[model samples]
Target: MTQNQTHDPSGLSQEQAKVELLQLQAQLIAADQAYHQDDTPILSDADYDAAKRRYQALVTAFPRLQEIATQLDTVGAPVGSGFGKIQHVVPMLSLGNAFDDGDVADFDRSIRSYLGLDANQPLAYTAEPKIDGLSLSLRYEKGVLIQAATRGDGATGENVTANARTIADIPQQLQGAPEVLEVRGEVYMSHEDFAALNARYMERGGKTFANPRNAAAGSLRQLDAEITRERPLRFFAYSWGDLSAPLGNTQSEAIERLHELGFQTNPLTQSCASVAEMIAHYRHIEAQRATLGYDIDGVVYKVDALALQARLGFRSTTPRWAIAHKFPAELAWTHLEAIDIQVGRTGALSPVARLTPVTVGGVVVSNATLHNEDYIRGRDNKGEEIRDGKDIRVGDWVQIYRAGDVIPKVADVDLTKRTGEDVPFDFPETCPECGSPAVREEGDAVRRCTGGIICPAQAIEKLKHFVSRKAFDIEGLGAKQLEMFYGDPDLPIRTPVDIYTLEERDAGQLAKLKNRSGWGDQSAANLFAAITEKRNIALGRMIFALGIRHVGEVAAKDLALHFGSWDELAKALDLARPAALAHRSADMAEDQERAEANREGRRAKIKETREAVLSRLELHLAAREAWEDLVGIDGIGATVGLSLSDALANAQERAVFDDLVGHLNISAPAAPTQESPVAGLTVVFTGKLEKMTRDEAKARAEALGAKVSGSVSKKTDILVAGPGAGSKEKKAQDLGIRILDEDGWLAEIAPK
Candidate 1:
């Protein structure tokens, strides 16, 4: 179950495979949190993708494991706390990745199989460059730009409407657009612009970004609209989300439609008739990648026909109809000069390698992630040998690899070139920042500092995350400014509450903020105004701002929606605290029992422990009810539930939470729309859909306010049955539910 352990399910027992699956899930979650939430990736894209492939392979080998492997169903990290949340009507899912031609062929074969098409069938696909930048969704109402959001956790996104309006490539008005259209695309910066921007930053003594993708993302997420406007950012429309009406009958036609509507569509987008053609187009795009000016990690191939795409539908996190054929990772050899342990917001001790500058894929790589102590020691989580058991050390020549704009990572160590003086790195057992003990918990890959708020590094990182674009984004208070303020004795803003009382506190200070370095009266006033503006914030934003472990924007929003108010949420958490604790104890006991059973070849003990835990849990009816209420909300699982309850249960944390909430007005979450004919109704689709794909039907129904279910239950209001309708259809009939044919279903959802 170690982070780097990759085992064939065939070589392991079912219990062992299950344990490994769980470990992979945890690792992937951490990876997603780092890459998407913190904008700091612990693993390279190539490594992360490989881990996912390994995870999928295990699930495929042990089919029953799929039931518990829920992490694969998620996309992106939770939305950060700062910006307004935009619920994506149609979730912006990710694409499956194909690292090689064989994978690409497999992708095509899978699509064909799902659609019941043979290899000789002339199924067409459109291949376009997958831009290595931030994903954006532009919502247009009445052919005019209404809002813009970043892909935050797929289900919901951060509102960047003002910043988006500043980009010239994004059209403010689309003449031929539908009444409601969500144009999805990439917000990117060209190589020239990125270089120029970095040069400008260097001239101004500001920190320069590492690559165009990072530059584009940082620019787009700016708190100040003017800052975003100043950045040379561009957008390319390639897809649609939440469309009121169809853009076109096919994928290529839809891109043309987007182009006609004044958005910049990729000129290299081409429709191919076969897998060979798709591969050829991928190669063509790969060849033109460097000359494209913008960053593109791969070429995306999507089913050309819109109807077929609908039929292909989507996996939990990725689309079934599309795949990204990733370009091979570029590698270069460099000397490892030093190893540095950096403490993150969550107290994780992350090891980074200082490398001799070398060019990889045209970008100079000076540093790479070591991942953890185990990776440094050339061992996987299971103590298995990796990198031929060649441990990395200072002065060692290491092979570093970079894929697209992903952060560089050490691939292997060249021990043959190692100097006599080179020695294995001695990872610290104490927090280098605060001298606190750094502990690595059981089953954890990385050690963490127990310094809590006392650790300056952890404190500063948490503060930065608090004021970050996704969190309580106060203009004029960026990471750089916050770091400066954190160390300032006169104006120390170490906590969230301090940010709120700054203006009042500054009024009485000997030297006011306006008189300080890099500040003026207007700028200080603007900062105050920004802080005040966020005083009255959304419930989800407030929850996310608390920085509770495992409580990201999405989880916060789900809790907000279920509780409707802070008081209710607090009360529920209080009641569920004991139950959550009990459940955690039970889970730990079950894990121990399972492990013991696996070792002793006894399964009875595991079942007995589970049943005992279940019985004990039932004894506390009120607590169990409250816990169920919290976890019953979709996406709120045991991990998040435990974290939420524990955060509230802790006296110190509760004091901090209370102090912070006292300064803000938290609004209730927005309720779902209920005006449509099928609003509030549960719907199920069965059999082989003809007029449209089952996914398309479900999307349409949900858009019209219906809850789409995979199964026909007693609560099912309607069943849309197709030609091959079987068990679900029969169940609906047995339940006496209303049944509609494909045509009838379409008619039922048609505009009044």
Candidate 2:
């Protein structure tokens, strides 16, 4: 959308620019939703800014076109459906951006001209690092923290006051503050915290995020605030939204007042008297970016005078009184030494470009993602030309850039520098790890190997997942030991079952292990003991250890709670497998071209699909209506059910599973210990609880063997009502459901 994109204003007619503007708005909206609401970004900030700039430039050229856009003033995507949304009194405005020195100079000049001041007139502005994290607003009423919301679409936000109260940095009560103050800030995670949290996730076999910004956003957006409480989130107040009374006449003074009230405000903020000082401060912050410990993509400059800021007003999307000086994208040209295909735990064949050593954004990057086959073939998803329409080769020079402190990516290929000996890479058709057929389903972007645990790479990864913290969690066994033994022919820890009998299998090999590098006799025995100790495990842990696709810790626990024991779970899964498979097949056949014929043909197609599913699931229908029952579970969806079906139906996987089960003791999830009368019953809590927070109440209920549900149903055995409870209580009475006031519930759960 920037004039830089097309390089000529005359070449683009007003109508064409309007069309481009419309397209850009749609794209920006989608991108914003993906990044801000979904915690997933389809495009980098660099690309987004370019599109935004183009839109802005188009509107500036065609002033009449401004009337058509409303998103021009939008800050972030509107609050998503995941959380309760709250409206904002003052819109959280986004800042204009300055990508280079010329842009910065122009910004200063534009401001002075708008105020009818001399070009050399001093303009005091507040400069601070622009934290790349979730924007939040904290509202305090009568010097008491009352509400917290996310910067959703600038005008509306998600209420996260409970979660905000959990962060130690955010004071629950503030002193010496305005009666009604809405402090705007960024919710961020430091690099150390981000790394630690990511390590914990990896240890638990949970998905890890790309960067601190993403981690922070994902943490704050959790439906369960307890999940957000567990994350290492911090807040830095830098601005204000709405205030009952003015705290200060200047921006810096207001920020200082916030800091004085026990709020965590950035200490690096400085007052710049001129554009030179602003640019200097920007460079200073840019120089320290590598050591900041948190992610910051740029430096923000705001007009210090509150009155001036108000007078300057705003553009459709950004404040005219403020602009952000973005740091240059770190990129380096390096030789594409080789292209390597790595088989991930999900069996995805990801292409990685091995590059000549190059430092990007202060880190030495030796590899970058090639993305997919389309990227390698010099085309985008829509088959449009890219990488200058030149295919990348091993000997070609490529540009690697680290965008906004995330993973490095090969941005472009230098076709002119490609050596004559360079040849296009031929992607493999079979799994490089196990020789299994690699498949690319229709519409799938990446090819995945059909091999499950048979592939050594997949096996090792799965075994590592089995021993993860959320799975078996063996004391002495870890990823390193698993990989070491997976490579060693003498080791008995090749499979999960092998661990159970390791003490006996390695009795003579103990001394040998002691002699081997990085191992000793005592450590080996400790590992063996640890393995033996985990032989008797809860059903959920056993299920998680199996590494069934989409069967995470939560799903495993859900299944264990429902099925109780190993035999029961195994029987249910076996019966459910066929139904799940057939249902998935029918679901995948989205095209109705076959039904284009007459009524009989249509009926036959429908009957064929239905019969095929029922025929495969005939035995399972008698065994708990397998697929339907599975789909009804809280977390289980059609996709997950299908994955479970695949795992259970495969003969190799089943054999391996049974063999592993034979050596272990799998029990039901532990039953209640008579702590409460309602132990093992489903409980529903409604409204606010004075004695404890919602999280605390839920935790106590779960500890007492009650499944705490969000809503009351026929399955709900107990309904606990607190103050303000209305609908749930009325429903409980109509259903003749047992009801308890908060105090009554507490008394019932008390030790008798």
Candidate 3:
């Protein structure tokens, strides 16, 4: 989309340049959205920027493109409308990014100089990784999540309540929280999940996603619940918006308060006293980005003090209090000698470009994903074949770059450097692992081997996922344990059932197992007990333990809540299988109808299906429901119900499950209702509270079902203001509100 800058040797008219510039601008914006928001980039950043520069030149020359395209205008407006407009309690402003160590140091100097505070004045900041995903706001009233919206225009956003509810880390009901609160954070996919998803996409004849961000956006934006459910998305709370009362006097304290309120805030965030230390933290994260499990475009630095931040706040869009320090993008050049096609866990044959080792950033690169045959030969003037290019050959010497230093990709190629010895990459005709005939589906790009469980890659990854911490959480037995279990002939541990059978291992063989360095009698006993402990697992945990392709913690919880028991859930999934398969088989079928029907009938149909399946399958649906009901409240959704039905539909798996459940004793989730001493009351703390800080006072108030208002109103039931409470004290007196100083406020809430 870049305007042709070649002197227009033909002497093009101004109108032509203007037209080109506008088109280029549109293309650039679309590419940015795809790359940044959606994680799929149609153009490389370099290509996109090149286009932008060309557009900028024409805009500069004609000036008409500027008026028409307004390429330099602010970001796009927020879209969607699920939230009924409620004014943000605190402005949810954007952050200005600082690209390097110098920028961070300069930010520190600016804050220090602006605040007129010394180094010892305690400028506490809470730094967290800037998650590269979609931003959202969750509003809670009376401790329950009422609405969840996207961060559209900093003011209004699209309502995404259903999707938000699907995120497990976000609580449905707040515990020890304010009357009104808004939690903000990003929802993202783990790198491993992104890789898997991309593999699946290519295998299914679907367009391969560019990155995790695009995958997340595409998944979340899908109208179908099933699609969202299938995505491996997670939420990490970085900050908040609005509160009935100030969370903390300082940024560090506010983060702590958020964590205490049962919100899943990142544990890695820290406070730094100086810019030097801040830079250290930023660099450390940059160095460790590859191991962090998710992507972060940069690190965010914010002024520590709430009062100071308020004093020096606001710009047109970004807050003066906060800035993001971005790490430079990592790119590397590697020689492409060969391209290898490997079958994935989902049976997708992915083309990988094997490269001669080249250093990019700090990491050495030897391979890059070709995506598919189309990707291999796709190249523009640049040698790289990505979304913007059309196929690359095996012999091309590809220039590669890492988008965030975490994902290595081919950037371009030095075709002149190509040794003419290379050959065109061939699409695989059979699965490399299982030797099964590979077939590319109608729309799929990569061919897939329908090997299913027979494939080693699929079986291994599935097993690893099955015992993951969030799932079964079998201690002492991790990926290594599972690998050994699968590989060892004598142990022969293959499934969850195999773990139970471990207790019955022959005494003669027991000695051999114990002799293994990491395993001993006690360790083996613990593993068996842990496995046993999960028997009769909570319906939700059981669903998660199964390691279905897309089901996660939150979805599992929703399924449990909706169906109430394992039997009910199993029936629902069974019914969904036909729909999923049918939709998969039909090229023109609209998935939306099936999705909607599944959503509407999720609860009712689950109950009906449970009754029918229980009679036919002879599973104890009533007992399961009773167990679920006794465990406390649960939430169900179409995704979990479908997964459960699909998983249990196999008679063999069901038999294994029956045995697994019989031995497991996972109690239902704890009851939601707990009796707290502080409930249904109004309390306020003013001035210096001696027993605790202002944060502690506010936390206690909110915990006790009392609304904590910032300033006194006539409606204020009790006001705890101390010695220096000035105007707020007078307001309380004028409003005839009960006023309690520090000691008085403490005494009332104090446990004798």
Using lDDT as the measure, the top candidate is 1
lDDT of each residue in 1-752, candidate 2, tens digit only: 23222333334455445444544554575576476546667654434554565456556666544533323444556566777888999887666666666677878888876666687676799999998888889999998888899876667899988888888888888877888999889899999999999999999999987778777877887888899989999999898888999979999999889889998889899999988899899999989988999988888889999999977776546788988777766778999888888776567677778888886754457777676676688865556676567777888888886544224567677777865877888888899999999997654556779887778888886777678554787876766678877777786466777777677777567668656646777787787788878888899778877777556556677677756787876776677776666675565542342444344454434334555545655544443365555654444556556777777677887777888888887887888866567777767788778776665577678778776655555556888998899998898788789999899999988988
* lDDT scores of the candidates, listed in order: 0.77, 0.73, 0.61
* Model 1, span 1-752: residue lDDT tens: 21122222455445445545555554566676576557776554434554565566566566655534544445555666668899999998776666667777878888766666678888999999988788999999999899999877779999999999999999888787799999999999999999999999999999998778768877888889999999999999999998889989999999999998899999999999988998998888888877989888888899999998887776656778887777777779988888988887667787788988998875677877777888789876678877888888988898887654235677777767966987779999999999999998766676889888789998887787677555676777876688888888888888888898888888745235446567766777788899999898889778876777666665666577557788899998898887888887787897787787889976546664655886866647777777766765545667778878887887877887788889998898754564578876777788888766555576677667666655565557888898989887887788799999988988887778
Model 2 clash pairs are 1-54, 2-54, 72-316, 72-317, 73-316, 73-317
User: Which ranges in model 1 have alpha carbons more than 4 Å from their true place?
Assistant: 1-97, 101-123, 128-248, 253-270, 273-277, 280-297, 307-323, 510-516, 597-608, 673-752
Best by TM-score: 1
Which residue pairs in model 1 clash with each other? 80-470, 81-470, 81-471, 82-470, 82-471
> How high is the lDDT of residue 558 in model 1?
55
Please give the ranking of all candidate structures by TM-score, highest first, separated by commas.
1, 2, 3
User: How much is 342 displaced in model 2, in angstroms?
Assistant: 1.5
TM-score for all models, in order of appearance: 0.67, 0.52, 0.44
If ranked by lDDT, best first, what sequence of candidates would result? 1, 2, 3
Per-residue lDDT, model 3, residue 533, is 68
Encode model 3's per-residue lDDT on 1-752: one tens digit a residue: 11111222123345334334434444554554465445555553323333443444444355433333333322323343323444455555556556456557666766765666556666766677777787778899889999887665456566677767776678899787889888888888889999999998889999977667767766765656577878888888777887887788888888888888887777778888778878888887778888998877778888788898886666435666787765665555666777776655345666667889876643356766554555566632224434355346766767776433123456566767656765666677878777878886543455668676667766665566566544675655666677777777887667677777777773545456766736766676777777666554677667777655335454565445445677665554554455433323332233344555678875222223333433444434443433322222112233333334455666766777778776676554443354444444445556665555565566566545454544454445777887677887887788788787777776776765
Q: How close is candidate 1 to the true structure, as a TM-score?
A: 0.67
